[model samples]
Target: MTRAHGEVGDPPVGKYEEPATPEAAADRVEDVLKLLEGRWKLMILFQLFGGRVVRFSEFERAIPGISQKMLAQQLRQLERDGLVHRVVYAEVPPRVEYRLTAWGQSLCPALDGLLRWAATRGAPAEGVSDS
Candidate 1:
């Protein structure tokens, strides 16, 4: 079966394989960034963090400016990436919910580290100007 990124039968989900060189490491990190390269993806991920099980309509309400189609697309991508778990209930109207998988939950600290790193950029470098 074909998987995300078009690799066939690559079954190591959430397993980290250390890159051989620093440049390779950089490339690997950038690849992960590519999976998250959308306006609403990060917002959706932030909502899924902290073990929250959010419904489709709730996501619509929480993330302003995102259309229904965009939300569904983003969620599907996350699910395909093994990040989000989707659950559907057989109720009157058919309830669907989304939450983070264990591997997805592991991203909390990495994202938190990113947040800290961004926060630590006190000012521009010596020659850089904010203007």
Candidate 2:
């Protein structure tokens, strides 16, 4: 069988080459993990998952205990990573909103799986304990 480019079963082309070695694979994983290494990025992504565009104040309210500086910083990072879209509207008071990009929306399933795993494993295993 054959598949067309960008089809569901089609192999990745262009710069999407697979890692050549175990070390390279690990490096790739590390790179992704680094992109998502902070406490707030996933939460920010989760809030943006439901197709609702949120403003800065809304995000501040939704995520309790996050400072304005921190929220702004995280949002900037997410925007840099191409996972979030920031739209600014010119109005009397200046309005800005945030929504997930297509790349960000693509992470929904993986986030859902993580949520499920966390729900099922609420407590730490034998030798593990909260830090």
- Per residue, candidate 2 scores C-alpha lDDT tens digits across 1-131 of 22211211221235777999999999988987776778898889889997879999999999998999999988888777767777777675878788887777877998788788888776767787788
Query: Which residue runs of candidate 2 sit more than 4 Å off their true CA positions?
Result: 1-15, 118-131
- Number of colliding residue pairs in each model: 0, 0
TM-score for all models, in order of appearance: 0.80, 0.76
| Candidate 1 vs. true structure, TM-score | 0.80
What C-alpha RMSD separates each model from the true structure? Answer: 6.2, 9.5
Q: Which number leads on lDDT?
A: 1
